[model samples]
Target: MDFKGLWTTIKKNAIHLFKKARKAIKRYIRKLVKHTKAGDYSVLIYTIFALVALILIIVMFANIFSLGGKKKSTLDITTTEVATPADVTEDPQIAAQMALKQQAMDIYSRNKDFIFLVDENHPLAEGYSFEHHTLNCGLDIDKRIYNDFSEMLNACNMAGYEYNIINAYIDKATQTELYNSAVAHYVDQGLLEEEAQAQVGKSVDKPGCSEHETGLAIDLTDVEVLGEEDYKSTRGTDQWLMNNCHKYGFINRYPANKVSVTGVSDEQWQFRYVGREAAEFMAANNLSLEEFMELVQ
Candidate 1:
């Protein structure tokens, strides 16, 4: 749900809870007034009711917004959910579309350059500039990450499960093409253009802001082309790579339980090369790239 929709849901639930509590309060007040032995406890009964209502409201706000976390004042939520194959089967058209979208996310997850939050409160940076190098599959990656990236791929190949570059470098124009295509895919799913674009923006980055532009990343898969891989067959063995990818200076960029922090979905097949030191630390701690950056900064 979008921000407004979430608020509406919270408000709706809160009001429902409040009303239920109010009814209980009234029942208690009725009991108090009915009791012959009671003194002037009407004021006390009403005060208790007020405290209960206030506590419920406070708890509601805290649960939804995470009031007590040192790092989070408000929840870092996006309207989009990471679409899975199971999510689209009912609509074959959307299923087919989601299949393609999944490919894009894999690309984005692997080599798709993205913005990291500039501060504790930001999950997205307002701007970025990148210098990159040409890599396999016509992909461009940030020049600095090349040696570790190459070493990582080499090590993966040596391990018997060969990994190939699906996409590495994406220029502004090409990235825009991917983003526009994602927007259209959602529109085809029946979302209005405005909402479709907003939805797509979360799954795919806009031009100049993508991680592929940074060239420090890559999207690797067992197969070279989009449609060739047997995803089911490879599923059982993915962890070996996940566990070892860090040694070569790569980390599963969007890891499980970190969608809230990274503003992206988890992708098991995607890895981001962050030099060995940072990569090892992140993997050891199960930290998302964003979280790792936060701790270091």
Candidate 2:
């Protein structure tokens, strides 16, 4: 398909994401409503938080789908109606999704012309919640995680394998550099600049949108840090790390099997620190970080 057709497909998929979020939120509220109906004074705060969460979802999706400057009447109406917390309970699903358009752009990176930019205003800031940790591999991760991660590294070393921290905790500027470089590469391959930018979006998340900014995500290798070519070629498998990393609180952030939900290609070397408890749960259930997050939080 052409760009427009490809974009339409992307948008359609993005809409599915919004729907998924809407349903999940609705399910959460259903459990809380009983306490709310009984007027449990303490539950009021949770109610407010849920409403705020709904608003964040709406606003984020609105920016993603409507970035092209097209006047989306559905979102406009939905935003208008849900003016306050009171409106969320009135029509949970509609209020939840009134803002997300019928598109998926695979939140990997939005496909819409307007959504090409990252929603810097979205609830999660790149690594805003994680503390910094300096690892001996010459890379820094979220603080306090060094112990668990180091144990994983040490296990690899003991196995007569060496590991390299390919990248960890990139800042927005570095993300911009990677993004621009990817776009340039695509352009060199003969794609139009705009298409190249979108293609870049598919892989290199917008500067402020990358999870690596949080220091919880890391790209590693079993051999010396080589260029992507070398990294790919020398990507020796340290089964000790893969099978046992989750025991220490990391998971393959984007596994090949979950590409449909993650919207990114599999990177066996990429891992994210979700904590041991959550990691175990995720691994046990065969869930991706995205799915686990949707369910638990």
State the lDDT of candidate 2 residue by residue for 22-127, as single tens digits. 9997887776786778887567786789889999999999888777785757766777664676556468676544322121213213311111112232424434
Per-residue lDDT of candidate 1, residues 175-281 (tens digit):
77998899899899999999998876555777666666556556666653354244432442355567787887787776556778776653445677766655665
TM-score of each: 0.51, 0.53
Looking at model 2, residue 88 earns an lDDT score of 60
Off by over 4 Å in 1: 1-131, 188-190, 224-237
lDDT against the true structure, each candidate: 0.64, 0.68
